[model samples]
Each structure stands twice: as C-alpha cells, then as structure tokens.
Target: MNLTGGIVLYAVLWFLTLFILLPIGLVSQEEAGEVVPGTHAGAPHRADLGRKMLWSTVISAVLWGGCAWLILGGVFTREDVMNWDQLVR
Candidate 1:
C-alpha cells in the first residue's frame, strides 16, 4: 500500500477501535448519581477519553502493522480482492 492508503487504513482502524472501546467500562451519570444540569442521564460520569484514546492508538497500531505486513508480503493483491467472486468457482 502507498502512504495515503496506509494512513487511511490506520484512520479507519483507529475510529473503529475507538467506537468499540467507547462503551466498555462506561459509567453513566445516572448510574453515578451525579447527572449534571441539562445533560442526559446517559452521559458518561467519567468519559476518560485520554485513556481510551491511548488504548485506541495502541490497538490500531498493532492492527495496522498486521495489515501492512499482509499487504506488503503479497499475501493478496488488488486483483484478488476485486475478483473475489471467481474464487468460489
């Protein structure tokens, strides 16, 4: 993959990882019994975004490394992906 492709892949992986991690270990304001004024009860009592973001970066980097290895190692090519239907025959 080219530089742009690698960057895009990492970005997608990062966001996906972040979303998946977002709900884990969450504590809603209502559950914590400290709902701020005008805020939804479901709002996080302590989002801990910094820690989540750090974890996301670490996980995304590992995934990106594996993906990069696959692409660079020639395990599959663009044609393989594009002609996936033919493999069923």
Candidate 2:
C-alpha cells in the first residue's frame, strides 16, 4: 500500500477500535446516580476519553502492522477482493 492508503487504513482502524472500546467498562449517569443537569441519564458518568484514545492508538498500531505486513508481503491484493464474486461461481 502507498503512504496515503496506509494512513487511511490506520485512521479507519483507530476509529473502529475507539468505538468498540467506548462502551466497555462505561458507567452511565443513571447507574452512577449523578446525572448532570440537562444531560441524559444514559450518558457516561466518566467517559475517560484520554485512556480510551491511548488504548485505541496501541490497538490500531498492532492491527495496522499486521495488515500492512499482509499487504506488503503479497498475501493478498486488491484484485483478489474485486474479483471475489467470481471465486464463488
């Protein structure tokens, strides 16, 4: 993959990881019994975004490294995906 493709892949992975990690271990305001004024009870009591972001970066890096290796090592190619329907025929 080119530089742009690699960057895009990492960005996608990062966001996906972040979203997946967002809900884990979260305590809703209702559960915590401290719903802030005008905020929904379902809102997080402590989002802890900084920690999640750090974990996201680390997870994305490992995932991206594996994907980059596969792409660069010729384990698969774009043509394989584009022509995937034919393989099932």
Candidate 3:
C-alpha cells in the first residue's frame, strides 16, 4: 500500500476503536453495576472494578494506536473481495 492508503487505513482503524470504546469508558463502574448502591468505598471489589475500567481504557487506547501504526506501516492489509475464488487468484 502507498503512504496515503496507509494513513487512511490508520485513521479509519483509530476512529473505529474510539467509537467502540468511548461509551463504555465514559460510564462509571458504579453505574455499570460494579458497585452496589450502598457499598462503601472501602470495599475491595468496588475499588477493583473502577481500577479495572481505568486500566481497560488505557490498554484499549494503546492497542488501538498500535493497530493504527501497523496498518499505516503496511503490516496489515484488507482483502479486495470476499469470494473464495477472488482471494485464491
């Protein structure tokens, strides 16, 4: 792929990743049922869930960036057609 093609692919992948993750990241764990309404902050599970969500968001961002880099670097490519014969030839 050419440089422009790579950049386009990267942008597409980055946007897709952000689109999928932003909603979940924006919501708090308390709202997601990680913590019961009456639960105290001292509860381990409550705190753990919040931490997990944070880490998940960070990891997802890093992964998305890496995928964009790979796409732009031509390390990955999309198939032109889905049919088996088209792919074989």
Candidate 4:
C-alpha cells in the first residue's frame, strides 16, 4: 500500500479499536451508585481516556501490522480483492 493508504487504514483501525475497547471494564456512575447531580447516570465514573488511547494505539498497531503485512506481502494483492467474484466463480 501507498503512504496515504497505510495512514488511512491505520486511522480507521485505530478508531475501530478505540470504540471496541470503549465499553470494556467501564463503570458507569449509575452502576457504581455514584451518579453526579448534573450528569447522565450512564456517564463513566472514570473514563481514563489517556490509558485507553494508549492501549488502542498499541492494539491497532498490532492489527495494522498484520493487515499491512497481508497487503504488502506477496500472500495477497489488491487485484485479488478486486476480482474476488470471478475467483469464487
């Protein structure tokens, strides 16, 4: 893949990973019995976004590395995806 393609792929993977990780181990104010007066009960008691983001980056790097290897390696090429229907037929 080209530089832009690799960047876009990693960005997409990063956000997807972040969203996937967002709900894990979360403790909502309601669930924790500590709902603040002016906030939604479902709001996280402690989002810990910096740690989540760091983990997301690490996880996405591993995934992106695998995907990049698949794309850049000789195992598969863009042409294989583009002509998948014919290949299946």
Q: Could you tell me the C-alpha RMSD of candidate 2 in Å?
A: 1.2
- Candidate 2 per-residue lDDT over residues 13-66, each given as its tens digit: 999999999999999999999989999999999999999999999999999999
Off by over 4 Å in 3: 1-47, 80-89
For model 1, the superposed segments whose C-alpha errors exceed 4 Å read: none
Query: Of models 1 and 3, which has the larger lDDT?
Result: 1
Q: List the residue pairs that clash in candidate 4.
A: none
Compute the lDDT of residue 4 as modeled in candidate 4: 100
Error of 3 at 68 (Å): 1.0
Per-candidate Cα lDDT values, in order, are 0.97, 0.97, 0.57, 0.93
Estimated TM-score for each candidate: 0.93, 0.91, 0.36, 0.90
Instruction: Score candidate 4 by lDDT.
Output: 0.93
- The candidate with the higher TM-score, 1 or 4, is 1
Candidate 1: C-alpha RMSD to true structure equals 1.2
**Which 10 consecutive residues of model 2 have the lowest summed lDDT?**
74-83
On the 0 to 100 scale, the lDDT of residue 3 in model 1 is 100
RMSD of each predicted structure: 1.2, 1.2, 8.3, 1.4
Instruction: Give the higher-TM-score candidate: 1 or 2.
Output: 1
